[model samples]
Target: MSPRVKGAVLGLSAAALFGLSAPVAKLLLPSSTPLVLASLLYLGGGLGLAGLEALRRLRGSGASGREARLGRKDVPLLLGVILCGGVLGPVLMLVGLQRLSGVTSSLLLNLEGPFTILLALLVFGEHLGRAGALAAGFVMAGTAVLGFQEGELHGDVLGVLSIAGACLAWAVDNNLTQRLSLKDPLALVRTKALGSGVCTLVLAWLTGQPFPAAQVLGGALVLGFASYGLSIVLDAYALRLLGAAREAAYFATAPFVGALVAVPLLGERLRPLDLLAGALMAAGVVLLLRERHGHMHTHAALEHEHLHVHDAHHPHAHPPGTDPTEPHSHPHRHEPVTHEHPHVSDLHHRHKH
Candidate 1:
C-alpha cells in the first residue's frame, strides 16, 4: 500500500497502545512515586527496544537495509526530542493529573493535536484543508464539553496552564520527531527512551523518591515495553510516512481510546460524554482520510538515506543481487524532477508551501 495508508495504520496503532498506558499507569500509581514510575516505564521501553535490537542483530542484518542509521548531526535533534517529549512533557502532565480528575485530564490532553497542527502548519509548512480545520474544531468541542468540570481549568488556573504547557511541549516534540523520521525508527525510540528514562530516574533519586519493589519496577517496565517501546516505534514509522500534521490528527484519538480501555480496567462508567468524544474523533479522522491533495512540484537535487522502493520518487538503481521490488535503505541521490501525485508533506514531499 501507499505511504499515506501505511502512516494512518501505524498512527492508529500507536494511539491505541499509548491510550492503554494511562489506566494501567493509574493502577500502578499507588505502588511508586511519580518521577520514579515515569522513569521505570521509560526504562522498560528503552531496555525492551534494546533487546529487540539485539535480536535483530542476531538475525545478522547489518546497518544497511530498510532503515537509516543516526549520524553525528542527529545528536542535537535526538537530545531535544528526548528532553521535550520524554521528560518535560510527561512531568507536566503528571503534575496536571495531580490537580485534575482523570476525565478532565484526558479531555485536556486532546489539545496536543491542535498545538501540533498549529506548529506543523505555521512553522513546518504542513498542509491542512478547510475540512481539516472544522474537524479539529469538532473534536476540540467534544473534548471541551467533557472537560467542563463546572468551569475552565477545573477552577485552578495553574493546573490548566500546566496541562496546556505539556501539550505544547509534546507538540514541539512531535514536529521535531518528524524531522528525524528518515532514520531507523527502532533507534529513534530507543534513544528517546534511554535518554529521558535515565534522566528522569536521576531526578527522582535526587528528589529522594526511593525505588519501588522489584516486581513493581518490572511491571512498570513491561508497561513501558508495550505502551512506549512498540508504540513509539510505530509512531516514528508513521511520522516518516504521514508527516507531522496528519499523524498528529490521527494520534489525537488517543484520549478516546484511553477512555474505552478505562471502562473495563478502571471500572469507570462510560457516559454520553465519552461516546460524544469518540464520535467527534471519528468525524475528524474521516475528514482527514478523505483529504486529497496533489500538485505538480519540483524536487531539488538531494542526497539522503532512507528506506525506499524503486517508486516514482526513488528512481535510483540498486546494487547487484539486491531486490528492487522491496524497500531498502542506502545513501542515494535524487536529481531534480517535477511530478504530480496525491501526497502529504512527508520527508520526500517537503515541497515549497
Candidate 2:
C-alpha cells in the first residue's frame, strides 16, 4: 500500500486502540481499582513498550545514535510531558470514567480534537483557516451537545473539571511531542511510555491501592501494551507519513468508536443525541479531509532538492546555454537552496526568479 494509505490505516488503528481503553477500564472498574491504581495500567503499558524496544535493540532492529539517548536538555520537557500526560491525564480520566457513564465519557472525550487544534493555533502558530475554524466549531458544538446530554451541566462539577484537565494535559503532551527534536521514533515512544509509567506507578503506590490480582495485573499489562505502547507506535508511524492535521482528523473518530465499542462490550446504550453527535463528528472529519483537496500547493524548502516540469510559456530565464525556463519547459528540473537551521531546512519558500 501507498504511504498515505498506510498512514491512514495506522492512524485509524491508533484510534481504535485508544477507543477500546474506555470499555476495558469500565470492565476492570468492578475490581474497585482506585484511579491511581488504574493509572498504573498506563505505566505498565509504557514499561511494556520500553521492554519491547529494548528487545528490539538487542535484536539489532531498533533505532540507535544520539537521537536514541535522552540528554540533559530533554529532561525537563520530558518530565513535564510525563507529569501532564502520563500522570495527571490518565488519573483524572480514570476517576472521571468511574463516576461518568462510559458513553458519556466517550462523547465528552471528543473535545480533545478541537482543544488540540485551538492549542496548536494559539500556542504553536499552526494555521487554522476558515475551513479549519468551521470544522473546529462543528466538533465543539457536537461536544457541547454531548456534554449537555451527558448531564455534565447538572452533575458533579469536579468530575467535569477532572475530565477537562485530562483533555488539557493530553493537548499539552501532543504539542510538546511535536516540538521536540527527537528523531528516533521508537526511542521517542519508549521515552514517553517509560517516563510517564514510572511517575504514575510511583504515585499509584503512594496512594496505597492494593496490588491487583495476578490475572487482572496480567490483563492490565496486555492492555497497556496494546492501548498505550503499540497504539503510540502506530500513531507515530502515521504522523510520520500523514501530516498532523490529517492524522488528527482520522484519529478524531476515536470517540465514536469508543461509544460503539462500549455498547457491545460494556452494555451501554446510546441515545439519539449520541448518534447525532456522532454524525456531526463524521461531518467535521469529511470537511477536514475535503479541505486537503481544495488546497494543493507545492511546499518546497531550502537545502532540499525538488524537481518540477515548467511549461514553455513560464517566461523565466535559464542559465546561459540552458533551455529557457517556461511554463512547460523541461521534462524535469532540479532546484536546491540552503538554510542555516535544520528545523528550518524543510520550510517552504517561494521562488522569485
Candidate 3:
C-alpha cells in the first residue's frame, strides 16, 4: 500500500483502540483512584510491549536493523513526551472523566486534534493548507459546542478545563514525538510507557492511593496494553509517514469512536448538541481525508538514519551486502535536489512552503 494510505489505516486504528479506553476507564474509575489506574495503564502497555519485544528477539524475528535507535540527544525530548503525554495527559483525562459523562468527555477530547495541529503550525514549523485550516476550525468549533453544559456550570467547567489541560499536554507530546518519529517506534513508546508508568505509580504510593482490587487491576493493565501500548506504536508509525499536523487530523476521529462506544456501554443519552458536534467533527475529518498538497520544493544535502526504501527522496548508494528489497536503516546522505510531488511535513518534507 501507499505510504499515505498505510498511515491513515494505522492512525484510524490507533484512534479506535484509544477511543475505547475512555468509557471503559470510566467504568473502572469507581474501583480505583485516577493515579493508580493511570499507573497501571502505562505499566500495562509498557510491560506488554516489552514482553513482545523480548519474545521477538528470542525468536530471532526482531527487526532492530530496520529501525534507528534513540541516541543521547533524544533524551530531553523523550522525557518531555513521557511527562506530558504519559503522565499529565492520562491523569487529567481521568479526573475530567470523574466529573463529566463518558460521551461528553469523549467528545471534548476532540480538542487534542486542534491543539496538536495548532502547535504543529505555530511552534513546530509545520504548515497546513486552506482546507486543513478550515477543518481544524470546525473541530475546535465542535469542541466549543460540547463545552456548553446548559445549566451545570460549576461541575462541567472543571471537567472541561481539566480535559483541555490534558489536550494541551498531549499536543506538546504529539509534536515532540513527531521529532523522534524516525526512531524505532516500539522501543520509543516502550521507554515512554515504562518510565511514565513507574513515576506515576511512585507518586500514587506517596499520595496514599490504595491498590485497586485484583480484577480491576488486571483489567486496567489489559486496557493499557491495547489502548496505550499498541495504540501509541501505531500512532508513531503514522507520525513518521503523515507528519504531526495530518496525523492529528486522522487521530481526531478518536473522540467520535469513544462517544459512540460511550452511549452504548455507559448507557448515556446524547443531547441534541452532542449530535451536532459530532456532525461538525465528522465533516472536518472528511475534509482532512480528502485534502491534497503538493508543490515545487528543494531538498538540501543532508545525512540521517531511518528505515526507508529507495524512493525519489532516497536514491543513495549502500554497502555491498545490504538488502535492497525491503526497508532498512543505515547512515545515508541526500544530495541537493529540487522537485515537486504530493507530500506532508514528514522528515524529508519539512521545507518551508
Candidate 4:
C-alpha cells in the first residue's frame, strides 16, 4: 500500500489502542495503585521503544541516522513538552480516571481536539476554514451532549479540571512537536518516553506512593507499551503522512470508540441521546476525511498536469542549466540563447485539461 494509506491505517489503529486503555485501566485500578501504575506504564513504554531502537542500531551497524539526538538547543522546548505532555498529562489523566466515571472521563476527553485546533490556529497560524469550523462545531456539540448525558456536570470540579489540564497539555505537545525537526521518529518517541517516565516516577516517589505488586507491575508494563509506545509511534507516522489537521480529524474518533468499548468492559450504559451524539460525531469525521482526501487528490492532479506539460515542451534540454527538473522561466523575458536559456518559458503557465 501507499505511504498515505499506511499512515491512515496506523493512525486509526493507534486510536483503537488508545480507546482500549480507558476501560482496561479502569479494570486494573482495583488491583493497582494509580501512581505506581502510572510510573510503570510510562517506564515500560519508554524502555520497550528504547530496546527496539537498540536492536535496529545493532543490526544496521549504527548506519541508521534517522534517530533524533537531543541537543542543548532543544533542551528547554523538549523539557517543556515532556513536562506537560509526558509527565503532567498522564498524571492528571490517571488522577481523573480514579475519581471520574469512565463515561464522564471519555466525554471530557473529547475536549482535546478543539483545544488542539484552537492552539494550531492561534499559535501556529494554521488555517481552519468554513468546513473545518463546521467539523469542530459538530465534535464539540456532540461531546457536550455526551458529557451532559453522562452526568459529568455533577462530578467533582477538581477532577474535571485535572482532566481538562491533561487535554490542554496534550494540545500543547501536539503543536510543539510539529515545530521541531526530528529526523528519527523512534528517537523522538524514546526521548519523550524516557524524559516523561523518569519525571513521573520521581514525582510519584516524592508524593509517597507505594510500590506496585508484580501482577500490577506486569499489567502496567503492558499498558504502557501498547498505549504509550506503539500508539505514539503510529500517531507520529500518521501525522507525518497525513498532516496534523487531517490526523486530528481521524484521532477525534477515539472518544467514540472508547465510549463503545466501555459498554462491555465497564458496564456503562448508553442512552438514546448518546447514540445520536455519536452518530453526529461520526458524520463530522466522515465529512472531514472526505474533504481532506478531495483536497489532496486535486493538489496531486494539478502538480502532475504542470509537470507533464513542462516535460513535453522541453524534451532536448541539457542536464544542467535548462534541465526540466528546474522551474520554467518567464516566457516574455529577453535572454541570449545558450544551454542555460529557458527551455520551457512558461513561468506563469496554467495547466488545462
Q: List the residue pairs that clash in candidate 4.
A: 66-184
Tens-digit lDDT string for candidate 1 (1-353): 87778898999899999889878888876757767877888888999999999888878664433587888989999888988987788788867878876666766777888899899889987777787677666666656655554434352677777888899999999999999999999988999988889988887877788887877778889999988899989998899888888888777777677778888898997778677878877887777777777889987899988877776778887678775546677788988899787888887776775
Relative to the unseen true structure, what is the Cα RMSD of model 2? 9.0
lDDT of each: 0.81, 0.62, 0.83, 0.64
TM-score of each: 0.90, 0.70, 0.88, 0.71
Clashing residue pairs found in predicted model 3: none
User: What does candidate 2's lDDT look like per residue over 1-353, in tens digits?
Assistant: 75556766787799889778767866865564555444556666677877876776678641232123445666777777788778888788877876766556655666676666667666654554577567656656655555455334333667777777788888777766654423455666778877777777777678776676777777777787878878877886665555454556667666667778889898889889878878887777666544432232333422211222353212234566753332122222233333332111011322121
Please identify model 1 stretches exceeding 4 Å from their true place: 60-65, 94-107, 145-159, 317-326
Candidate No. with top TM-score: 1
Worst 10 residues of 4 by lDDT: 296-305
- Candidate 3, 103-175: lDDT as tens digits: 5775577678788998998888788989888876776676667555655333488998998899999999999
Can you write out model 4's per-residue Cα lDDT over 1-353, one digit (the tens) per residue?
Answer: 65445655776787777767767877876665666666677777889898887788677633233333445766777778788877778788877877788777767877787887787667665555577568657766766676665344446888899889899998888766654423355666778878888888887888787776677678877888888788877777666555555456667666667778889888998888878778877777655544432121111111111112233333433345543424433122222222222111011211121
| Candidate 2 Cα deviation (angstroms), residue 329 | 35
